[model samples]
Target: MWAELIQEVRVAQTGVQILFGFLLTVVFQPKYGRLADTDQAIYIVTVVMGACATGALVGPVSLHRLVSGHRVKPRAVRLASRMTLVGLALLLATMTSSLLLILRVATHDGYVPYLVTAVVAWYVLCWYALPLWARRRNRGGSGD
Candidate 1:
């Protein structure tokens, strides 16, 4: 369980780290100042969300390191899993906000909100709904 959790965390951690890095750089770009006040606010929120997600995704590793040899692997794995879920949720928010800011700046169309909503719904379905459905469907099946 620990190994599997670590593997999953690695995938999420890499993504969040890259996203947070990019978000960090955006503030220094010249165009960042040209954004509207609302877009600037959105960018700020998105950057904060990215930072939080990166922290949550990296938490499992720190948890494991600190708890090593404490005979608490199972408990650590559960906590880490919870952190990963939280991280994923934050990542979704970050992505949505990033898209909203980009679309608003690029097109200024009335459909941007609807388009972002659709994309977010798709992400929720892919990232949460499908896995939840699978878990429920397989709950009574063979353990293997």
Candidate 2:
């Protein structure tokens, strides 16, 4: 379980780190100053979500370090797994908002929110719904 937790953390950690790094750079871009107030607010919220995702994805390492010799591998793994889920959820929100802001700025279309909604639905289905369905199936299968 510890090994699995470490492996999962590594994947999410890298993704969030890269995303957060890019989010940090957006503020330095010249066009950033030209964005509307609402867009700037969205950017700020998205950056915060990115930061939270980064922390949650990286939490298992700190957790392990703090509880290494306590003989609590199972509990630690469970907590870390929960944190990873939370991180992924935050990442989804961050990506959705980021996409919304970018598309709004680039296209100035009235359909940006609808497009973002569709994308959000896709993410929920792909990331959460399918996995949850699998879990239910696996857990409720016949004892045979």
Per-model TM-score on C-alpha atoms = 0.96, 0.91
What is the clash count for each candidate, in the order shown? Answer: 0, 0
lDDT of each: 0.94, 0.90
Report the C-alpha lDDT of model 1 over 43-143, residue by residue, as the tens digit: 99999999899999999999999999999998999999999999999999999999999899899889999999999999999999999999899999985
Per-residue alpha-carbon lDDT of candidate 2 for residues 1-144, written as tens digits (9 for 90 to 100): 678768977987888899889999999999999999999999999999999999998898999999999999889989988998898898898889889988988998789889999999999999989988888888868632
**TM-score of decoy 1:** 0.96
In model 1, where do residues sit more than 4 Å from their true spots? none
TM-score of 2: 0.91
lDDT of model 1 at position 56:
95
Q: Candidate 1: global Cα-lDDT?
A: 0.94
